[model samples]
Target: MRARPGALQVGSFRGVPIRVHVSLLVALPLLALSFGGALQQAAETADVPPGALSGHPWAWGLAVAVGLFLSVLLHEMAHTLYALRHGGEVHGITLMIVGGVSELAEVPKRPRDEAVMALVGPLTSLGLAAFLGALTWLVHGLGMFQVQFALFTLAMLNAVLGGFNLLPAFPMDGGRIVRAALTPRLGLLRATRVAAGLGRMFAVLFGVWGLVTLNPFTLVVAFFVLMGAEGESRQVRMKALLERVNVEALMTPRMVGVDLDLSMQDAHWALRHEHVSMLPVTSAGRPVGRVTWAAAQAVPEAQRGGYVVRDAMEDGVVADLREDGWAALRRMAEARVPMAAVVDEEGLLAGTLDWNDIQRGMARAEEAERQRSGPGWPRERTA
Candidate 1:
């Protein structure tokens, strides 16, 4: 059977579309409110005549909020462009409450490439700020008072956004710069450890100050930074350990199988008695589809005995054991496939390999390798 298309698609400008996390959707209104409040305060402080720009303060504030978000989009786009230029593919750009992220298919392999990719986003923001500042100054010289004021506000906002993003925290541009610099010399793991450690330190300090000052937003940001850094570090370690491993080593050779002609009763008994949730549907010794206990349960008891396994089974894509484990995993994740049938040289079902099994096997292999190289083990003689 043909493999299913992965969830991620090459979108406009070769970017992928990433569904914004539900949490981000929940936070959008709050972010808009904060930006609007900032604009309202700025306008009030400037003694701008009420109803001059918009009849209501909220209207003007919302405009500023929208403009700020546009600036953020530009910042994320800059990162995505640089990544693509350097042979990396971007999944998508997501604008979260904290800021935005340009999700890449893989991190840059070289430290120099990493540094360039990390630095581009902030630099783009800074350049925008500088250009707007220059335009504001020119407008002031030309005696365009209203234009000057609007440009000035935009310039200042962009500067603040750039500065905030550069605050040396993990998952931030500044933190990425630190990691990039250290990667070549200290290695990715050590570099991540150092960068993440610094990030946690900042997170703790921010968290404490937020609590003492009773600022819930600050607390939220601190917690977000802390968790992001921890998760990033763990993911890096996991990828490093599993690199270059293949699917064959991790799959189960003896998968539960059912003939297409078998009645739903046989499938149900196999599911319940054998404790196997999934069964490969076969006909003439070849896999045709897959049946799960959940599918079996969906049928009414009265009709269950009359149904054939083929009638209830769902056709699924299978993976070759010789394929790269990491690539297979990525495909599975993108396709939203729970499990893949592992096939051997002749395209016959060799076994089944799921995501959990691959992770567990890699962990065990790494552990074994570590023990073998530990003290008291004789090193193999080299020519």
Candidate 2:
């Protein structure tokens, strides 16, 4: 399944693409309710009468919600900015019901860099809380009733948010710091396993607590944390497994091709007569584009005689075998492109590689390892 609420590029900062998922729109109102409720409770506790607040209930709710989201945005931006300073690419920052997430294109290559990036977000939140707390204290000393109460509540909420994020759980800023600390000694995979395991444990605790207490918020948070940890772990494992692997190792070098000048009728005949599902549209031994069965099907029978292969073929990114295959694969996967053109050392079209080919190669590799181990090796069941 795709990530909920399709992603949209909002903007960029320092070359880092900022994206937000559509589901974030749903989260905003919930965040407003949560923060507004908290602020309302705090105001009551502080002996501030409800009517003294400047805005109506809905306006107050919206204000608190905006403040909370602003805090979250700052926290996530800290992570993104820190990563950029370290020469790592930040894909985007996403806000969800649980909290915010800053996606880094790759993990920090150095332990120090990782630690800095992980620590920056929480530190930023803490700094904001402190600043707000000072402002609240100053306003209280100056006998400003409404402003002091509002600032105090906002500061307290930020402190709580920062404290919660610093919990030693996977998918949290603190957990990332833990991973960074353990990376040198345990290696990245083992470090990730530890962090993810702890994260899952915390998620289970949240879930069980929610069930016992009948708190829907806790249950939702548990699910979010669980899924986030699992996803991160799976991504790390895939990247580790695919390291140094090239497209040439798995591509079908015997890819069939049709002349670009050929009519759709000719392409359709080839499709019917040949077993291949797609053909590389080439001209004079140079690669151009792809003509698939689906493309041919779209052409009317009568028009097929006049439609050239170029009219039906779609353009795609082509890569040489010597390039970083894992990077290329990651790009293809992210773009949702189904296939990649694999080229030889001389940059000539050598073959085509699809997602199936990659999976098949991985399967064969796993099977070969199993056979070499004489069936005594522990085999983990996979989904």
Candidate 3:
């Protein structure tokens, strides 16, 4: 999970870290309102004393909200455990209002692997539903109607959650299963297109249904579904381009370090000629800062010829020699830096991994993928 500023790290489960997303704060109260209403209605139906609803309906609402998300956490864990066993690395899991997400470094390598991982989440939900159903039954027989009502509500919620997630939409388990089954025959991009297309269709249908029924919850879910499916398609395409690449292959070994005496005009020429936005500034082979276009332009144009690159540069771009290129892209994208100073184990400047480098690598990989394919089929990773 990508931890934003102020995000709380709860703990780790079997080395898979879990964190609470900020949105969970908003989701909790909303869930409390919805579930609280249901609980109050159940009390009225069961003819429980008015005190149950009147005394502490908020408490009941809070319990349902917390309990509901606990089940969602388990659903994500099932995916985390299964993914780790299948040549994938678990970055972490995150709990949010909509549900949980299992952050994996890579997609599964095989169709069977994808199918298994996708199927496990829904199966976990169904299993929980069955257990809770049994508990609800036992409590009912013991004349603990209040406990039974709570248990029954949870059981039904799980059943609904499991069923709802089974909708064949991209970014959902059933959609993944559909893509997995299709990947063997159709190429990956084609299969992905089919799945994503179906997902968008369903999203529209779900949105329309939500509107017709005046259910804002369903409409919100449909919006996420649509965005999720669209986002996953882009993710797959980017992964395809990045999968075969290593950072070392893309890094420029010649570090163009501009000294403190190198004029801003000289540095500007270097930046333009090299097609790079930033260059490492060094003094006597020791690092000082980085000369960025923004930084260089900040210097008065009239005095640019006199001002040195060091006068305008700033620091903080760094990457390791053997880091995965995709990982590097993510780090760079997050930092919003155009280039990184590639460093060796001893912390010496080794090379530079720049945005231009990534684009070139992506272009080469995409070209190679195209060249290796025949006329009818899309380019694919060879089996």
Ten-residue stretch with the least lDDT total in model 3: 46-55
| 2 against 3, candidate with superior TM-score | 2
Task: Kindly report which residue stretches of model 3 are placed more than 4 angstroms away from their true locations once superposed.
Answer: 1-7, 42-55, 243-254, 258-351, 354-383
lDDT of 1 by residue, 161-271 (tens): 888778766878888889888877777877887788888988999899999999777898898889878977876766666655778887778544788999998899888
lDDT of 3 by residue, 16-111 (tens): 778888878887888788767776576665445455443466678888889888888888899998887766777778887677778776677788
TM for every model, in the order presented, reads: 0.79, 0.85, 0.73
lDDT of 3: 0.77
Worst 10 residues of 2 by lDDT: 374-383
Clashing pairs in 2: none
Best candidate, lDDT: 3
Which candidate do you rate higher for lDDT, 1 or 3? 3
Write one digit per residue (lDDT tens) for candidate 2, span 118-198. Answer: 888888888889999888767764656678777876787688778878877788887888888888887777777888998
By descending lDDT, how would the candidates be arranged?
3, 2, 1
Ranking, TM-score, top scorer first: 2, 1, 3
